[model samples]
Target: MSLFDDYHPLKGKMFQILKPDGTLHPNMKPLLSDQEIFNLYQKMVFIRLADQKALMLQRQGRMGTYAPIWGQEACQVGSGSVLQKGDWVFPAFRELGASLMMGVPLKTVYLYWMGNEEGSRAPNGINMMPVSIPVGTHPLHAVGTAWAAKLKGDKIVTISYFGDGATSKGDFHEAMNLAGVFKVPTIFFCQNNQFAISVPRKIQTASETIAQKAVAYGVDGIQVDGNDLFAVYAVTKEAVAKARSGGGATLIEGVTYRFGPHTTADDPTKYRREEDIEPWKALDPMVRLRFFLKGRGLWSDEVEKQVTEEAQQEIDQVVKEAEAVPTPSVEDIFKYVYAEMTPQLKEQMEYLKGTL
Candidate 1:
């Protein structure tokens, strides 16, 4: 069957459970048990708090430019929860929560924002790559990894995270094309936050939706409610399973909103209207999940306080630890790029050493 075959009746519509009004959609049954749902909620809350703290750290000049993952907690946690220890995650710059879910240390995430190269290295056996900041380039790395896994008969899936803006890049097409041709077990997750820096998504591409582009590449294309944690989790879980079962690749376009500035260096007030953000706040993913949990009798006021406190304490500790890491030495920059330094690189390294 073609990846975009007629088997998936819910292709364009996708599957979503929790709604904006904090109620679960009747048609969408909970694939996870109540305990799992509650756990997801707690994880989302923790990740959100960590993201906020990172932003504050950036503003305080303790870290380099940071990307706030506010309003997209569900998108990260839901999708990230699907991976096993063996599956690999290739992340773009904004996926801190996803990285944490995939076994990256929270301190390392903070250390990354603090400009330490060591922070980029995932723990041994974590199967994650350093954050790729140059747009859609990392998808190719994901494809390569998936191809290698396929060759070894490992059945390990590789998921690449990028933004909607990345969909417009040549690398996105190349990676998608190669994955489709090779039938690699890969997932191209495009977080359609509707903006590429200052450019609104309307101008990003003429394509109606990023998922639709998958049809051309012979991949199962899907569009999910990015803010709905349950929906994101369900779709990603299915995609990962499909990949593992040799169903080839899938492209998931998560339609979500960005509530804050793109980064510390960005000023959204200059380009976007204030009203553009107001409606999305009403659709806040965290609030929806919290409401759902409350309806299920899994959340209480006391629990809220306890969880918030826990999240805050963890964030505080990560901040302190990340800040404590020593700054990279002048020579450290010249060390990692190549195994055997070229003559020009050696000369430049000597010059940097003399300057230091």
Candidate 2:
């Protein structure tokens, strides 16, 4: 049976294959080759370190406030790794790992948080959109892109990454409605990390499961164990395939938690407790996945040491490259607002330059 059918939202099912201890489920199998699993594991480790580095950069006053995807690596990598060439990803601001998985350079990711507009440009042929910082708005853009692609007869699927907070926004609902009516090939991937900044998930909506919200839009939906790499991979891969084959949209709620503060500007301790996060520490996506790999003889302490050192070296270089880029010119601030700058904007730009 398909993942969606097997774990229907109303059935209140949450799909999972790997237990917190790295043990596999009796009947379910991972949808990855041994080599593929190892590759993804490496990617996850790199991302985890990169995430910590971003936090450090922010704390050191080198970068601006940043969102930490500390504990959501599986949700990002598993879903991103499955997309084929030509598929597009629309990321909310927190999707640093997912963007990298989708082929965005680590330098660009750093540049974005470093306040460079040049960072907005993804490489040609990689259709990832610029980060949408506004809460819950990019779902509409994703659906629109998907609709346009469908109209143009392009065989590409589009996926949008959002948090649980996004579900409370009107854009999410509107996008779901449109995707359903038109049967556009898109995936609404909600990384439901249990909080929208300081607000808990329960306060955002009364819905028992975010996936069940898909029922209102007449689309397929499922809740998966966001920490389980195998489960996330299985669900996302199936959803992508279904959408690619003209099966319309699917809403996937990956139930996970963020082990850090929501962003550099926010503190979780003010609202939640260490006790709350203690349990999830055991369920860390990295820990279980690492355990699974070690059991298969694909990973070891030496391997981890090497990977971490290599990741640190690579990320350190990316930081240098990002910082080396020239700062934006004064004109850059006023030039992109319109095809031609208005006299008012021109006057403001000139006034600012005069002051500088």
Candidate 3:
């Protein structure tokens, strides 16, 4: 018998419920009700608008550099929709949709990009860490938090979100290994958007799939079509259930695409061809979901108009609030970096203050 005789046949296949043409797989219908699906659609539209508004703000010099989540809304919203109130989320910088779903206000997200420390603060009783700009480091933090929760007999599970590039980091491997060994209730959610900035996914790893990395760590892994909201929701819901039931850890690789430049500072056209992106445009998650809803009579132009108008108004208010907040002092940056200021830091702060 071959060494792979017992291997899972579906390991490399992308789990998909909604097909790209807006039809559902006959046997893989989503468990969500019509109203629930509508609600999810509304949330997706809201975040897409917010994301576009942020990009515009950055261009207008109203905000600092931003990472746009244009094409990956379903990946974030679908997975994030499954979280319970008490669960924790650790997000890399691109997870604005996930943060928003977890009760981080629009104004706070805007405030964060505008360089305010207050934007990082999660509301009381909300379990979300500030955005981790250092790539793969937060997975370790998520694992640690989950391990602590396990030790304390708390039922909460933690989910860590990172990009395709993060999988190459030592911290990612260490966290995965530790989480598996300890059997902590953690979900390692990787949104494989095909590029780590200008670097393509194929060059990022020699492995056939990012999800298969879980095999070495002895954790369960699944690959989902991140553009299919139904598939993303189903996989994440199953993972969350398993974690709560002491099933150790799981890794989910969401195969999606980023439709914009990596960030405000980067130009994607130099690295990616227009023809390469044209195919993914046909697979846009929002368009697919809208078609599904329309076929079921749950969506229409009027509904789309209403949702768009409402979201734009809400975003307008959030932009106003964010801009009204005063710019953070230079000391604000140094203050949040330490629990109690070290002597060296104190001296540096004094010198900086003197210079000001």
lDDT winner:
2
Instruction: Sort the candidates on lDDT, descending order.
Output: 2, 3, 1
For model 1, how does the per-residue alpha-carbon lDDT over 1-356 read when each residue is reduced to its tens digit?
53235324345565577898778788667688989988888888888889888888888888899998888788888899999989999999999889989989899888888888888999999988998889999999999999999999997999999999999999999999998899999999999998999999999898888888887888888888899888888888888989999989999888899888999999999999988889898889988877888888988899999999999998898788777777888778888789988889989999988986
lDDT of each: 0.87, 0.92, 0.91
What is the lDDT, from 0 to 100, of the residue 138 in candidate 1? 95
What lDDT is obtained when candidate 3 is compared to the true structure? Answer: 0.91
TM-score, cand. 1 vs. native: 0.95
- Poorest stretch of ten by lDDT in candidate 2: 20-29
Per-residue lDDT of candidate 3, residues 225-270 (tens digit): 9999998998889888888989888889999999988999999999
Better of 1 and 2 by TM-score: 2
Model 1, runs deviating above 4 Å: 1-14, 353-356
lDDT of 2 by residue, 157-262 (tens): 9999999999999999999999999999999999999999889999889999999999999999999999999999999989988988899999999999999898
Models 1 onward score TM values of 0.95, 0.98, 0.95
